[model samples]
Structure formats: C-alpha cells, structure tokens
Target: MRQRVVVRHSPVHGRGVFALKALEAGERILEYKGELIAWKVAVRQHRKQGVSGHTWFFGLTDGRVIDGGQRGNSARWLNHSCEANCEAIEIDDRVFIHALAAIAPGEELFLDYQLITDEPADDEIRLGYACRCGAPGCRGTMLAASDS
Candidate 1:
C-alpha cells in the first residue's frame, strides 16, 4: 500500500496529519501510540510543561490516558476541526484514528477534540483552550460545551 498519510504544518493549528491518498469512509487509518500513564500523572506532566498552547494527551476509556507527548506517532499531530473528517476510537486501551467520511488526497485529517473538563467552561477556561479550526460552526473552544 502507498503511504496513506503524512505529518506537516497545519492551518488549523500547529502540526497536523494529512492524507496522502484518497481514503474511504470507515477506513482504519492509524493508531495513536504513546506512553500509557494515569490521568493524574498526565495532568501533572501537562502542568509541568507550562505551555499555554496545545496538548498531546488522549484520554482512554479505562481511566488512563495516552501521553502522546512521549513516544507518540504521527497521529499525535492530528488537529481538531468542528466539522471533522476523522474520529478517534479507543479500543482495549488503544486509540485509533478512523476516517469518518471520504477523504481526498492532500486533505488535512481532523478529529473533533471534544475535550471534557471537570469545571464549568468560563471565559478564562474557554480562552485557555480556544479553537482555531476555522470551521463554519467552530465552537470557539476545544473544550467540550459542557462539563463531562
């Protein structure tokens, strides 16, 4: 099979994953590989990083998270889009990126980063995790609309 994707600079955010060839809907793209860490540890590391911008922690269903910042693959560069073309599926402690719709060659792959937060989404919180996907219906923040 040909190289299906590549990581490059993205207009949506910083770096992002882009499809190198046409992809069919429902196609399993790539696994989001990283260091498995507890949620608390992930939080601690994220805070320690002291970066105000992006993050690479992907939550898993089993209460742990994949710290993509360490030992991560190209999938970690995938950015968020309100009108996403891809979806992240967590299965058995692993997360995979899947095409949600037909994707054309050279198209940037996107996933709805419906990030959940324990606190209410106030202005300060929303500002911290602002969205720049530029989708028509962009929610303005990567944070989920409501606390989860």
Candidate 2:
C-alpha cells in the first residue's frame, strides 16, 4: 500500500483494494485523529433522529472528545464485515487497527465495526446498509440492539 493512500479493487468487498502493491502482514493501513469526547457528551450529540448512527468515542490529547461519527479520518470510512481482516484498538485513548493476518495487495481491508462495541444503544439504529461482510451465516441486518 502507498504511504498516504492505497487503492485496490476488493473482490470480497465489491471493488475494493486490488493490489495497490504487495502489502506485508500486520502493516499500518491508516490513522484516525480528532478530539475524544466523554460517553455522555457523545451520546447527547449523536442522539439525533432515525438512522443517524455513530462508530466510537475517544478521549483526546487536547482534552476534547473525538466522535468517529462527527470527526474521524479514513479509518472512519472503512466499511464493516463480519468476517473481517483487520481490527480496531485503543492505546492510550488513540484508536487504530492492525491486520490480523497477511493481507494481499489487492484485498479489501475489512474490520468488524462491532468489534469495538458489544451492542448498540437502545435508540441507536440503522437506515439501510445491510451487513454483507461475507461472513458465514451473517445476520442480514447491520443494525442490532435497536430501541424501536
């Protein structure tokens, strides 16, 4: 993958990464940077009407909250898959992902967005995007733990 950006047509993920170049296993894909807000504040701001969802909340270096929903980097754009190839972790409040195994150059990097969360909040909901992570016996709906 390139230093800044990597482009590939992912077979597993409908036109994703396609060998942007031979990438090593456990390589750094991208970074998500922004403020980190407390759970209370994040829930308040993100608690909008229907379909509007959020990813994760983090405590920032500048003493602010960075909600992956409102302000996040490329990692935020990465889609979710049940059979994921990547992972998300928080070290000292900084969130990141590491390849679980060797990812081929052209393979689309995938991570289960749910890995960071056990279950969605009561009011948290999904609009349309269904879960097609290609994982075995996947629950068709991506939105789980819905209040409505």
Candidate 3:
C-alpha cells in the first residue's frame, strides 16, 4: 500500500507531516513510536539535554512518556495547531494519531498539544512556551489552561 503521509518543511513550524492522499475523519493515520521511559526518566533526560522550544516527549496514560527523539517515526513531525485536524489517542500504552476531520491531499496534519502543567500559567511560563499556530483563536501559548 502507498504511504498515507509525508514529511516536509512546514509553514506552521519546522518539519510537518502532510497527507499524501485524502484521509477520512476518524482514520488512524500512524503510531507515535519512540523509546518508552518512565516519567521521571523522561524529565531527567529532557533536562539533561537542555532541550527547549520543540520536544518529542509524548506523555502516556500511565504516567510514562514516549521519547520520540530517540527512535521515533514520522509521527514525531506532526506540528501543534490550535485549529488541529488530528488528535492523538492513547490506548493500552500506545499512541495513535487519528484524523479529527477529513483531510485533503497535501494538507499538513496537526495535533492540539493541550500540554498540561502543574505550575501556574504565569507570564514567564507562557513566554517560555509561546505558540505560533496562527489559528483564529490561538491562545498564544501551548500550555493548557491551568486547572488551579
């Protein structure tokens, strides 16, 4: 079977995954594969690497995280968008990026990285994690609204 997507330079961000063919809503696009690690380990590795801005660490339902930077696939290229066309579904400790809406050929796939944090959404935190999705209602930051 032909590949359903391709990775290329993205106007939204760095590299982005685009549809090679029309995709129907609810179609399972691809798996977010990577090295599975404990949440603490992922945190330590991220800190040790001094990585910022972009990240490939996807959180799992069980508190573990997928370090996509290690052994990730094309799924790691998906960019964040406030108006997203895809959604990441975690099932049985695995993550699948599924189409949230019908996507046409050459359209870039996006996932709403509703990244949650325990810290307060202060000015410093917001500026550090600023977003440039350019969506109509973009919240200006990738960090999810603080629950506290």
Candidate 4:
C-alpha cells in the first residue's frame, strides 16, 4: 500500500504526520531525491540559494550511497521534537524510521529534527507555522529538539 503521513490536531506542535497503519521496525518511510553530490559539493550547495538545494549525501568507499536529503515526500513534512516518537536508522542504503514504542492508531509520529545536524531553529524553520504535538517533555519552541 502507498504509505501516507497524516497530520492530526495536536496540543503541542499544531498538526504533524502520523502513520496510517502499523509500520514495522526498520521500515522504509521514503527515499530522498535530487542528484547525489560529493560532500564538499553538498556543503557548497547548502551555501547557494539555488532551487533544489543539495541534501546531505552519503557515499561509502565502495561506490555506494544512501541519500535522504528531503526533496519531498512525507519525510519532509515530518516534524522535530525532543521526545520524538520514532527514530530513523540508515541501513543497506536506505533510511527508515521505526517506532521506538508502539504508536497508537492516531498518534502523531515524530523524529528529532536536529539529530544529524547542528541546524539552528527560528520561526521560519518551524513546520506548519506552529507545533502542538503534546509530547511529554515537550519544549516550548517548535523544532527545538532538545533543551540542552
């Protein structure tokens, strides 16, 4: 079945993506798009303001890559939270987000936005204008993955 991320009314981070069905552990959520660039190229691309800006690309020494740079799909719409409900682990050239705990039928799914980078957060980076995820240990700021 075509998986879809649904946004539900939340008390903490406004609306956020939730899985429509039970997603197995290590399930593939979506694959990132756009051309794969070298690490330096990706960094320079981040500096430029071009449309379709480069995403964090990965290439192993054996000429393989697992790029999940957020061009589109529900992965882009997914939000950040300190107490994220899910975690994405890279395996066999694919990025997968699985439930750390059993997510209920309608619970909003979350993954910590700041996990892999030192991305700064302001009003603009906040997805959907505001956050209301109501996750326990919720930080007041949207996209603030941690209070520390």
Best by TM-score: 1
Candidate 1, residues 86-116: lDDT per residue as tens digits?
Answer: 9899888889888999999999999887766
What does candidate 2's lDDT look like per residue over 80-120, in tens digits? 67666776665776766677777775567766654222235
Give each model a TM-score.
0.85, 0.59, 0.84, 0.49
- By TM-score, the better pick of 2 and 3 is 3
Model 1: clashing residue pairs?
none
Instruction: List candidate 4 segments past 4 Å from native.
Output: 7-15, 23-70, 116-148
Candidate 4, residue 66: the lDDT equals 33
lDDT of 4 by residue, 1-148 (tens): 3764575654444345777777655555554333444544443444463423322333333333334453544454455566877776656545556677766666677775432223343333333223344567766443334445
- Alpha-carbon deviation at 43 in model 1, angstroms: 3.2
Model 2: what TM-score?
A: 0.59
lDDT per residue for candidate 3 within 1-29, as digits (tens), equals 35899999999787999999999999999
Error of 3 at 48 (Å): 5.1
Q: Rate the local accuracy (lDDT) of all candidates.
A: 0.80, 0.53, 0.80, 0.50
Instruction: Estimate the TM-score for candidate 3.
Output: 0.84
Each candidate: how many clashes? 0, 19, 0, 8
